[model samples]
Target: MKRKRIPNKKWAAPVLGLALVLPAALPAQAATPAQAAVKSIEFVGMNAPAGAQQMAQVYTGASVKVTYGDGTVKTFPLAYKQLFKSTDSVGGTIAGVSVDANGKPIMDTSAPNNPVPYVSDAPDANSLFQVPGMSPTSLGGNPLSLVTHYEYITSNNAGDSAYGLVPASMSLTKIDQNKTTGELTPVELQKVDFSGVDGLWIPCNGSLTPWNTHLGSEEYEADARAYEADPTQTYLSSFVQNYYQDTTKKGNPYDYNYIVEVSVDQDNKASAVKHYSLGRFSHELAKVAPDGKTVYFGDDGGNTMLFMYVADKAQDLSAGTLYAAKWIQTSAANGGSANLEWISLGHATDDEIRAEIDKGLTFSDIFETSDKPADGFATIKTYPSGKTEYLKLKPGMEKAAAFLESRRYAAMLGATSEFNKMEGVTLNAKDKKAYIAMSYVEKSMEKDSKGADPVDDIHVDKISSGVTYELSLGGGQKDRSGEAIASDYVPQTMKGLLWGEDLSAPDAKGDTAADDKVANPDNLSYSEQLRTLFIGEDSGMHANNYVWAYNIDTGKLSRILSTPSGAEATGLQAVEDLNGFSYVMSNLQHPGDEMIVPDPLKTEVLNNIDANFNNRKSGVVGYVSGIPSMEQIAAAAPEESGGGQISSPADDSLIPLRDTAQAAGAKVDWHGKNKEVVVTKGTHTLRLNVGEKTALLDGKSVSLPVVTQFSKGKVMFPSGVWDQFAKL
Candidate 1:
């Protein structure tokens, strides 16, 4: 590993000036690099040029990421090629006057003396606002596309696993878009399938190695076909990718439950290390410490175990000790939950349980022979044909003969969670600690179940499972003088904290009523991001799709990635976009959530149409709380329980324009009579002289001043917007 100072055209001025130090190299054993989390990225006014027929301008507020690593990152030179990227100015344009859902202008894309090319046509012409795929659970966010989910690997639930795998290729061809204005610019970048990076077992999530390779987790070697066909049925290829797919097709075929060590070459050829040397069992994620030799990983599904591999040599994944977390659960109590704490059969102090697991294999047999060891636990074995088939632990202790030589690991690491164990893991080399992302799976019925009632005027239910939390690990070595729990690993940093945001208001002020169900990613979409431990979860215990972010330092959630809005994004291994936007990639279904649905053409039509015609120029749209509907009065009854009625004391902050409007002596009818409404044709102001029973445009009689209006998102008007009601 060498450090090359590639002068970056974009970061040269700001970054290079700082003269940051680069951690040149680490021992072959060191696994991952500390990615300094984003400290701040100041919004760089958008100015990229698009090469299109129409003069398009680009705009955006650019921000910088302050890596958690040593402050040595003074300057980062961005070269399209150094990072394997290509781009050009074509297709689409930045909105010269981008508006919020309320139709108020935000960014002005077209400015004089500016020089970014705008295109006439949007590349993908059919995609508009397409919703996502089938959700695994009822409490999750809207089912977005595979692209939106950004799932790097497709599990049996979302994809077909024919030949024990659902084979997919990660390659390239289009940008089709850039977040800019007017027929904007286009950048062409080729997809790279690093050499030895093909066979995908469990396409879960993981970070890139210094070697520029992907360390993917493979759950196990179960029947994925069965899982796909029916969750009720005992399918053999449970999590296999290519289980049911035709594997005869070479180069890119076959996948299973085994952590795949794959990489893409500069030439786009995918290579697979198809050896079953890495331990298996619902492998969820893999994170290599700075010491590549000492890689740490965790098992997610049925069993909640944390294991680390001490690679014998650099780059070699085989021949290592697999140790599980064994906590001194003397602190355990019966909280009357589904949480379980079982000791390892290999080292279970409980003779009964140890003997049970041992019935299948001795400590070493779990690794050596692919065959089951003559052991204890019936649960760990299955007699197939006349031979006993045991769980394949892989390369390290595959045979009982070798079990005598392999190192043993304690199974129970005192992880406290009800239902599902750990779902995400992130290691920080600079701090020498591991951040574990845990989902309660059901903290009172999850986050979005019927009872969560996310709306502002809320009738909330006791939640079953909507907890976001983490576990921290200390340096591996025990503290000097190994007297009691004497390892450097201390329990100082492990605990669950309250995560739901008490969003005072969805907006700066109260207007369109607030809803937690639509705000915080953690609460809204089960998505979060702190430093880097990204957690992908089901919205609730019952709802299955989600993404969460965990900061390794404080062990708290930070931000959240978008949901699997539709087909374009699903099963993604998230990476940051230039603007902190998450980008996911996969080779499963044709329509993923990654790209906009209906295609760019549809999006252009929809965005443009919504921006242009969907505006209400009149000071007000519609007023609520003033004239209560039958349903509103019913809703109000419950509010009394919380505190007061809808007409509770008005907080000035909540009514941003109340003072100015009050001074004008304008009343409710003034909305339609005093000002003009912006229609597709033009603004139309009404006269105040209309009498009662005036003929309505569509036969609904309005007291002349009463009218209907349209705008973006939603707006709740004040009594001052109109004069009087004239229904019926």
Candidate 2:
């Protein structure tokens, strides 16, 4: 691809010859407009100034003072960014330009000129990778490949609203992080193509497997009715036939809803495989135990059930025995613990399940064939005792029950199907416990006399405040391999480790009574090293949802970070760097609602709104790094140095002339006339428009290497202009 060049003559006016002259002596008062008018001009290259390599600290109101159980409180402020900003890193924006299968730019169908819109964007389920001693053939010569796996949430608005169309896919890219400055730059490498799995739907919160692969959860699967009702939708029609292998079974529920594994090689190539044996449901996250064989999954919907998939072999989820938890109430109340037993739904290989679907076996067929008694229960014969037990479904229907309608099958087989909006699940191997988040615990556990018999006595008042349960893995009879058995062993009751009611408090400003609770805990992740659980929320109860860190040992609940208004904190992953510094990677999805922007960031937030853009609501993925101790934060005070240089704490980079002009108490107008960006500091004024290399600096022409770019609706100058702005 050839790079476009800008005209230089239009920006080549002669300088005043005294542009670089600095006033040696000045009055106590500020310089007048005439004296301060810039006369000297010197164009410099793109390198940053000295000391720029050092990492700088930035703070924002989006912070929380976390009080630990040990009585230690530390305030951690969040450093955030929206879309791609040049000041963020040397590599500028790291967006993947949408391309066809043949590697050509995909032209927009709606545009008259058929312009190629860079629609393949938005980072989700971001996980960092550091593979040392990687072969040249693997990483294309880089011995160490530092990359982050980004799952594209949705392709476009149509894909989000339309259930028929499969959305955009995931991608892997090399991220260059400056060691000295702690700056990050993402470089698009390869788009992960799901050849085997066909494609994904609503790729949501995911987990980084122990074997170093990305496990992305396919959230909500389209109902079979949607596909059957509309055969004209080619995407749905193709998906039904390709995956299900039967056009007649258009509404086969088993075709979708599986955890897809994505592996990226050193060559920047990616391959995906759908783990059908893991069973299917509205999966929010699939977390593997330290053993890797036992996988725990959370169903993110109302009246769902928790699932466990025990693989035949370690680190292999391809072939597994799917089991559902049978919650046996040991205590009388809703928050009380309940003994958990895994009821075998069935076991089958991916090929075997697909073969059943190919044989014209539908979900209704399996449900109808299952044995049901008048009391509404299924019978399963015990292995050693040979005693027939009353459950909801027959044991023989594993092929259909486990793979097809897993939630219904589990419920029939005596699994607790009363969970409401069951979200992320993570296991603490060291502690031998697993944690599950229930976004609406009270609502989910509400008693219904007309509903199922198991939930008849369960009456709980609706509380939007969510809850997290910690299940104790009890001692169980071992299998031949001495592995902790699943079928026969029943776990001790689950305990409520953290309650949303306790976490809920008024906001710091005391503006509202219901301001500060962590509602709708959608994603949960456990860090073995820290013995802490990270909670990410997607809730409407609060103005902005937050990401919290709960210490299991100390029972300390800390609200670490919160999302902007109208956005959810997603893909929360806490990974320790090679230097052993713990960092969290999270995505702020669809932020920038004027109502949600804090008072401090209102101006900048409002300025970020671009009405003409497509992804105006798109948010950015940021890493919280260099967390300081409470003592350090208290000791350090704001500097009062007054210099021509101004810096942006958000990007941790030097502010451009536009921002600096405003900081210097000068008028800065944008999109005034001819969509131009005008900045006036002291007596000097600079004017430039988008897609123009010529800039009017103090009524004189100045040539730039490239046309100015817009980031988050603000005009941004190229890196080459940094040196010129430094002289101001």
Best by TM-score: 2
| Backbone clashes in model 2, listed as residue pairs | 18-40, 19-39, 19-40, 20-40, 138-266, 138-267, 139-266, 378-391, 378-392, 392-412
Residue by residue across 102-142, what tens digits does model 1's lDDT show? 22222212445542221101010000011112222222222
For candidate 1, the per-residue lDDT at 440 reads 30
RMSD of each: 26.5, 20.6
lDDT of each: 0.26, 0.51
lDDT, residue 480, model 1: 20
Q: How far is candidate 2 from the true structure (C-alpha RMSD, Å)?
A: 20.6
What is candidate 2's lDDT per residue for 1-728, written digit by digit as tens? 00011111010000001001111111113453232222211111111111211101111223433322223344444454332421122133324333333333333333355443434333456666544323333223222222232333233333332222324455565655453433455554455665455455556668888777888877555443223445453345543443233457344445567888877665546677888778777777788876667787877655567677878888888887887776666653435467666667777888777776667654345543323444655543311111233444444666766786676666655577666667777777656788887766653366565653434323444445666778876456443233556532224557656555422443432112133345667677775534557777665444455666665654545555655544556667776432213356666554433233245443443343332123343445566554332212222212221223322212223235477555555555554324566654332345678777777654446767667766675667765554444345
After superposition, candidate 2 runs with Cα above 4 Å error:
1-122, 135-164, 179-183, 225-253, 331-336, 358-360, 369-397, 449-461, 477-491, 502-513, 592-615, 628-728
lDDT of 2 at 137: 30
> Least accurate stretch of 10 residues (summed lDDT) in model 2?
9-18
